[model samples]
Target chain A: MNLMMLLEMAADGFGDRVALGPSDGGLTYRDLYDSAGAASVRFRADGGSHVAMADLSSAALPVSLFGAAWAGLPFVPLNYRLTDDELAALASRISPAIIIVDPDSPDRLTGIDGIGLLSRRSLMDLVDGADPPEPEWDMTGEGTAIELFTSGTTGEPKAAVLRHRHLVSYVLGSVEFMGAHEDEAALVSVPPYHVAGIAAILSNVYAGRRVVQLPTFDAHDWVTLVRAESVTSAMVVPTMLTRIVEVLDAEGPDGPGLQTLRSLSYGGGRMPSPTIQRALELLPTTAFVNAYGLTETSSTVALLGPDEHREAMASADPVVRARLGSAGRPLPTIQVTIRDDIGDEVAVGQPGEIWVRGEQVSGEYRGSAPRLTADGWFPTHDGGWMDADGFLHVTGRIDDVIVKGGQNVSPGEIEEVLVCHPAVADAAAIGLPDRQWGERIIAAVVLHPGASASSDELRDAVRDRLRSNRTPDHVEFVGSLPYNDTGKLLRRVLRSDLAHLGDGSTG
Target chain B: MPSLKPGSRFTSSVCTTQVIVVKGAGEVDLRCGGAPMLAAGAAADGGLPAEGASGGTLMGKRYVDQDETVEVLCTKPGDGSLGIGDALLDLKEAKPLPASD
Candidate 1:
């Protein structure tokens, strides 16, 4: 039940296969296994209760992750993008930890108490110098494997705890052991702090797929690397996909010549319809997958797979075609239910909070009680509805649902209609205080270059598709929308930025 | 009888067979090589496998009983077959899910 078992199996099954870096000169499964074993000895000697990483994606990430598991310590990856004060606050909470950092910036957490700093290069050197110990990782399966800090847009960040059993179940339920072909390679551009990044490493390794790390994301670099490495698959956030679509479009009709990429999965935010549509048109050979999950869930709980994507795009029926925006069906290993505010199950095609129960669902956070109900369902706070055909459509966060004159308005519904317009490039709908109605809807619009659409035209677009109550009261044309690094829209930031548009009264 | 629970490991006394329980509970006659398997790392009494159960087991494959109540994943290969009492376990077919990270 230890994370080391996966590495041990990989080492035994495919010792000679490349597991990381380039195809010819990368570390093999055996090498990674030995390095993890050696790193565990160093972690144990350091007397740290936890192992933390403050750097980007690299060989050090997998080493530290497995090494901590081998040493029976929790692994925590801190957001390197946080300011010094914010980083210090988080570091203090996980004090008495060994933090891995970039060699160039070793002093990132200089003043933190009881924190041991080890450069990535030095850690690698330790791996190269020391001989690994015999296989002896704890096998209870109850030990914490990872502690991810949620991107707290509303308030302070909370550390989401993932135990070994939860993660191992996720990998086993979703992936087959040694299923990937020897030539398969996956390009990972997400940072180490994200849950997707962690999942990508574990799943790819178990499936025996070679990994190529991209420390920071850039669309042009991503396209070039895919070609150079002959990468067969990739996972990206919505923001990254949008930029890549732009890059591919700029290369003309044939696209960026990415014949090697067979599958491309996008998630971590609400992908604008126009972006996904253009992407499908440009990359005709690639299989598009829309994965949906939260940090609380180990990773993806549901996915809209390749065949469904092509079917949704080609179908003429609006009901089937609209599945292009749906999250598809839940995983066979998980159970999903849409429950109302009173804890009652909603009818099919009805909107409610998404509650899920599964072996991979670890709805526990540090210092907080488990969020699971008596029956074991974890209420996700995400607003969504399941269609009669079983496709799940996610509206934004439940907290962002706008209540206007006793009617509930989903910003995602309005934004979807607005983004369909040819002139609109990106759009976000937010609710502002209004004296007349309980709240007034405001649409923040980003238009394509040199393209223009009047507020009346945009409002009519929503009014035509949906009920008149869903139309925006006002439209604010802006240069761009605010999104976090992981592609989640900063609605709270938007609400505050556009606060002046509403009356000062709380009504 | 050996107790079986998910995540418990077992090894055969006659051959190199090793398995981790994926789905099974309570005590049962979990046998390999026509002999009762012992907990992992337990001493084995030297003897050859029985004539009927010497087919062999493959590494990384899952074996399940006829009623599909018990499932065990082979972590190590062996010269002996795995079974519950008289009925031999069949290799479980892979479901082949789409790759999603």
Candidate 2:
């Protein structure tokens, strides 16, 4: 019911083990438990409806998260990248909350009424000096554990509510208690606001894996930290992985390889195939996992494990080779179905909206009705299909599907073919409004550094690989495609900027 | 006796051993040290464990019946083995799942 149960087990099972920060001298499970208890005391005294953090990842992240859980308050991690007005608006919404602020940026959030501000340093100091709170914690499952603001790539950000039971079930179903070896440590660079960040903390703690913090992520710094700390595992967004592959390639053969890293999982956005293929070649020893999940499904609902990656990449069968691009299978705890427009189940290999049902799938947003159906299935709005062998291939968001001449074209399908071309480094396919066709497919192409490709060649490549209808009506080579901080391609931004082009073929 | 359900927490009547049900749902004799386990925070009936029931429990280890019908994860360790009726539960070696996060 309470996430404290998971923490309490960790504290009881491996109290002396380092749970967070630098592996050599980080907070032990006992230290984290005590700090959380101390944090609960401060949070209860603040009389807040929630505990909020506006800073990047640090020791303060876990303390506030567990502390809030212990105190029976919803933990809200707001995006620090938001503008001042946006931050203030979100702060106002979570009024009467203890907002953990960055010490360097005090002026940004000061004078906000009903918001209690605690500097990160002061919060850590409080934990260091204070007595631990009583062990008693609310065990009910109905209380909200974390309220995360969706990235709102499509529209206005909604607060996605994850109850304690949902998270507890997710951790219990996916992770084995005290499963991690003593020397194992995981590097976490994803910002605190990300669902991956929260999931990383909870799963690692329950597995007894030590956490190494990376407050700011640059590929160089991430690679350096991995070597310096002997980090064995890590989770990254697709953008981070692309930069990391570039960094490793620059390191050359003699440079320190990712020898210590046993597992590297990437998600939160679509990963260009070339990057993952290059990464697999660069670090053949490391296991690559393709985790596909949304903010609504706790974290990873489906993951492509390392074995599948190797098999798919090495297999000669076309179907097996295509599995490399698939998200693999749904988790044992999750049930997934591809549904047609009428909400009926689609045939195998047929693309439809991905609907998932499980205890971990919240499908609920604050101030909005739960999105789950009466039977409990949540329409993910992601367009994907199940292969003959049960592998799930996510094409793209349904909203991102380009409807042209009464036919639906998946931008991802075209983007995949474009990226496979040697001259292309990245590609995003979007629909542009057209008078003749309901929507015209326009491809935004980011060529490899110093590489060039003509629109005809790219168009021929798509036309050759897929059907003629799937070919890009117009191809615009660009320096870079727009992506959010988490690596989700800003398709709307691309649509707006290129809207003026208006089926450039006509012009 | 309280019907067992997943996520339900129970405390040993004779020891500090506490557990949460990871699997199981029905009217069944779930016991610790040959004594029925009490609901968490329930008033304990202080007494010594029955003979042959003091084999003990390990912290963080999962115990399951032979048929795997009932499974419990120990939150706290104690000198009293967990059981279903008269059958002592065996230690379940947890298969480590692939780290997805």
TM-score of each: 0.97, 0.95
Q: In candidate 2, what are the lDDT values of residues A1-507, reduced to their tens digit? A: 788889999998999999997777789999999999999999999998989999999999999999999999999999999999989989999898989999999888888899989999999999985778778776657789999998887667899999988898899878988889999999999998999999999999999999998988899999999999999999999899999999999989887888899999988878889989999999999998999988889999998999999999999999999888889899888999999999999899988999999989999999989999999899999999999988999988898898899999999889989999999989999988788997888999999888989999999999999999999989998999898787789898998888877855442
Q: Each prediction's Cα lDDT score?
A: 0.90, 0.90
lDDT of 1 by residue, A68-168 (tens): 98889999999999998898889999989999998988888997889999999999998974678988876667899999999888688999999988898
Model 2 chain A: weakest 10-residue lDDT segment is: A498-507
Fnat, 2 decimals, each candidate: 0.40, 0.50
Best by TM-score: 1
Model 2 whole-model lDDT (C-alpha atoms): 0.90
